[model samples]
Target: MVVDSRSRTRASIVESAAKLLREQGADAVTTRAVAQAAGMQAPTIYRFFEDKEALLDAVAEHVFATYVSSKTLAEDSGDPVADLRAGWDAHIDFGLTNAALFGLLIDPARGGGSPAAAAGLAVLQARVRRVAAIGRLRVPERRAVELIHAAGTGAVLTLLATPPQQRDPGLSAAMYDAVLRAILTDAPALPTGDATAAAVAFRAVAPQLTGLSDAERSLLAEWLDRAAGAV
Candidate 1:
């Protein structure tokens, strides 16, 4: 088994590789590049990771860990629709908060024989199973959870992709509002304006959250604040 020191070194290398993969596409990520970024020698890098593929597999696992951490699904509340709205709000907040990491999760390249992807997919599957228990899935297809998940992802991507200077936080909040509309089977309409307003609206609804309290929101907000500054 790898000792603590060796394991730390390997984890550092994998983290550097994953960050690079998100910032620059996979083609630009080489073991040598990772070693240089991690401030280690090529042979030392090879000691932990066999090749770019192995490093990528490790990166996939690391990325999936973040996905697992970011599961914001809300269930078991008296109203499934309310639970779903809370879930949508959480999905938007987390996605906007971790835009790059979110991209890695939805990227199609990580499919097929990828242990990292399989682990992440497993988490998603389990979350969907909970939704199934809540009877939130559409009838005949049982894809309500899938549909809700996709809608949440799509709204967040649209919000995050827009330049903060060009658009405004209102757009992001609106996107999230639309997601709630879809999940609740209601007509789509959302507030619009600036990010400050969006932030205010975001905070205003914290009490209504399912399975999450204000303390949890504050803690999560602090974590996202630190991470958002890193980008």
Candidate 2:
């Protein structure tokens, strides 16, 4: 089919760009180079990608998709904290292995413009939500996510900037533990805790409660959020 053919062509172009990025860094992924690598004319690259920036975004996403497809997690870890640790470790490993892709993702100029960067953040957010569900999260889910993301990204960039022999191997785990100490309570707050802790625990699973109507759930979420934030 024409549609299938077009999809393959676009994928081929992205693949070529990704190869260039990995082999020679971000600056090597020029439109002409990608076109030649994919055995297509330069104008054909434009047909698939609006410009060089769009093509670079596609390449970042393509590389990320391939990397994530190779990683897996247990269906239910029974300990969401452990699951969070695993996710953090995997993220660091991904960054260290894919230095060029990681640099593209964390560049301040790109901000959140890259689809792959958003996807990576979404994965982290989900992992944080899982931690919240178990009532172990001390901070609100959003704050926890941001803290962990920033720390992990910082840790990876720090390591990448260091020469391999000089890199501090313990830095990533140390950073994760530091953030965990700030975010997770000793135990689930649902059973015995102050109102704020209880609110945090309840807010984590409030969406799944069948008895609450949509409006009721919305109101409850607002109130719980307030309760969670109250000192």
Candidate 3:
């Protein structure tokens, strides 16, 4: 089938580009190089991708999608906070292991529209939601998500900028702990005196408030979110 053949060709091109990126870094992934690696003409690459940037985008999405797939397939350990920590560790490891691809994925211009990046963020959002549901989250779910995402990104970029031998191995763990202290509570349940924690916990269950109409539920969620973020 023509469609199947096209799909295979596209996949081969992307895989070849990914290989170049991983082994030799992004500078080595030119159209000529990728085409030679894929055993095709450079013109064939144009048939598949608009330009070098487009090809790089494909490579980023392909590699990041594979990583996201693995994360999605992992079983949750039942402890939401522990699960979040595991996700953070995995993210840092991925960034270190795939330095070129991670750099591409984190670029503001390209990453803004990337489906793979969005999928990764969705995974983080789910993890944060679970934490909020269990009453451990002290901030709003969105705030918690933003804080964790920013911290993880900053940690990876910082580590990548440092020489490997000179990098502090404890930096990532320390950053995670600092983020936890900012966004989470010591108690497993909502504490009576902590209005922010109560608001966050309530926001977690706001969707399931079936007795309220949809508009009422939305309004309640808005109020709770505002209250949670007030701290």
Question: Could you report the Cα RMSD, in angstroms, for every candidate shown?
Answer: 14.5, 2.4, 1.4
Among all windows of ten consecutive residues in candidate 2, which has the lowest summed lDDT? 67-76
Local accuracy of candidate 3 as per-residue lDDT tens digits, 15-49: 99999999999999999999999999999999989
Better model by lDDT: candidate 2 vs candidate 3: 3
lDDT of 1 by residue, 35-76 (tens): 899998878888887787677767867776665555533245
lDDT: worst 10-residue window of model 3:
222-231
The TM-score measured for candidate 2 stands at 0.88
**lDDT, residue 112, model 2:** 69
Compute each candidate's TM-score over C-alphas.
Answer: 0.54, 0.88, 0.96
* Best-first order by lDDT: 3, 2, 1
> Where in model 2 is the C-alpha error above 4 Å?
68-74, 111-116, 188-191
lDDT of candidate 3 at residue 25, scale 0 to 100: 96
The model with the greatest TM-score is: 3
Model 2, 1-231: lDDT tens digits are 999999999999998898898888888888889999999899999887788888887888788876665543336577777778988898899889889989977777866665556666777777778778767877888889989988989999999999999999999999998998998887654547555556777888899988989999999999889888833
- Residue 65 error, candidate 2, Å: 3.5
